[model samples]
Target: MTTLVAIALVSCDGPTDAGAPDAERFEPSLTGSAHVPYSTSETVALLDEHTACTIDTYETKIDCVDSSGATVGRFGDKGEGPGEFLSPARVIRGPDGLIGFSDSSRRRFFVFTREGELVAEVPLHMLSIFVPISFSETTVLGAYTDGVGRAFFSAYMGDVMAAAEISLSTGDVVREWKPASVPEFPECEHGLPYYGFPAVGGAGDDTWVFMGCGPGGDTTMLRAPRYVAESPSDRDVEEYGDGLREFRRRIGADPDVSASVREFSETPRLYFLLRGQETFDGQGRLWISTRRGRMESSFIDVYDGVELVGTVEVRDRMIDFDLFDGTLAVLVERQVGPDDSDGVPDRGIDWYDLGEF
Candidate 1:
């Protein structure tokens, strides 16, 4: 079952009075950044202590680099031929040492080995907004966040859904995943929305979390609530958002969001607000970039499925962060203006030594 966990969050030993989650705040020491050819490295798979693979979507190539920032290898070409990619937008590591890459522009998905060997490729004409987190030679398994707004624009669907196993040949979702925790966007009905994602955590924009990593792309467990009822879930509503808010308040999140210059949550338009990202560690511990805190530095809440066991504070408003072999790689926004030189990269990846938990 998909779950918005209901677990007690205890504060870390030393920061009990900090108004943050009592979860232990693990300190991080800055390390050297991995050298990437471009600033478009978003999806990364940490291979080892000094080696990791990042997708340079700008050039449609996969780059593997070491701790010292030297390019160990580069693979993929921009073309329609075999082993070539038109626009590699997203990458996620799959089972059995395989990785999934989505070419958004060409409406194609590819599975490849770390060495850039093409394993499986599928042409999905309707694969516009659906990101393939797990796929095989046939099935395109993943989440589609746009489904939230689709039902609003088209005929309303009769059921609520978390994910879909889509087939371009059939032009429909052949199979689907349904979880009780998935938020419901009803059209005067009590059923679920057609293409909604889990939107509980104020953690960030990450839509879904994977269920269990196995041979097949089965990410039913990982989810973000894409849409909820017009009014926020009541205090008694114990869904994913409820659990996440409980955790946020414990971690020093200043509720009562300040009024903004533009449209706020009180508006009638569709809005899903969350900052930061979520990722799992080798030992199955879930680490999330904590937002809504009053501190200048960001905090990463480490969860053991059910409870807040630990937390890691970052030094900036991170774009994204990943951990590999006790090392943390944080993607930060670069300061660039119209007159900025080319040397001032648009993005920066900062490395850190993850302290003891």
Candidate 2:
């Protein structure tokens, strides 16, 4: 049951104009009081949330936490065995509340029950030369049959950059939509084609997809194409891609908004940037993050379908976030200097109570 939101396209303005309109502007409903750090026996990986599970990664092991922020006894350890994750890159909580993790190093999709039990590990070599799974928390992972499903954005060869869905029940590839029809991206000329995690909207009946990408170190936020329009002529897709690039440039340049384009290259042929990541409340609002520096200096915005509802300042350093049943959980790190671990800003688990908002 994949539903794509039909958005009415609008010319994007720079961030100076991206603020809340005077009429509907309400004080930021987000309030945060940090909790004591969960004493991790070891360091954790990036944080991902879903309806039933929240996952964090270590170098090779993954910790599964329940909604209460309590660690589940079952953890994912990577190895050659079945259900093992080898270099798991992303862990997403799906729309059906199922959990999905991509093992880029191993080239497989590990599907787990809410209880952290392994169910299936599907491979996506045909639809995607490699599947870089992002946004593992949404239901779209299995619901998309249109072949527009995508997971990650990376310039690295063998890194699954583009993906479309086959089915939710059985991990199958949609053969109809072959070699994903990505819009014209001029900025991806660098060795690494950058992409962000997937943001899904219009859940059950009306749904749409939005992804932001960029060159590393650039604070630009290029959005995905508006899929609800009439059949795009040859030029439409090109123009659409260009418009998104410009929109990203605009928002990245704004001072009130904490966004930037990052440029870190893993290989000589390419550079990298943090693509925009998202947290969608069960309803219409969305919380997106783009990075300016190494620290998680992120800005928050609320969106209903294509309309920007409100924007606010998220006062802390964060790397990733997840939302489910109206609860918003963020992953923050205490970044220490290169030489010393003592100064790493103490990281905590923070959840936003947004049911009424």
Which candidate tops lDDT? 1
Which parts of model 1 are misplaced by more than 4 Å? 1-17, 37-41, 95-97, 125-128, 134-141, 146-161, 164-175, 181-276, 290-298, 315-317, 334-346
Could you tell me which 10 consecutive residues in candidate 1 have the lowest summed lDDT? Answer: 5-14
For candidate 2, the lDDT comes to: 0.41
Model 2 per-residue lDDT tens digits across residues 90-193: 45655455556665456577777656677677765543324333333322242211122232223222122333554434546543222222232333332334
Candidate 1 matches the true fold with a TM-score of 0.57
Error of 2 at 261 (Å): 12
Give lDDT per model, in order: 0.49, 0.41
lDDT of 1 by residue, 1-357 (tens): 243322222211112224334557677887766546554334565555555567776576887666676776789989988767776755655656566767755667777777778877667545234555445445666654444233222211322224566553443567655343433222422222223333223221133332211111222222211122343222112222333343345346654323421222332211111211355576766665533231235566666654556667666445456666688876554444576676453444567887575
Candidate 1's C-alpha lDDT? 0.49
Q: State residue 142's C-alpha deviation in candidate 1, in Å.
A: 2.6
Error of 1 at 205 (Å): 19
The Cα RMSD of model 1 versus the native structure comes to 12.3
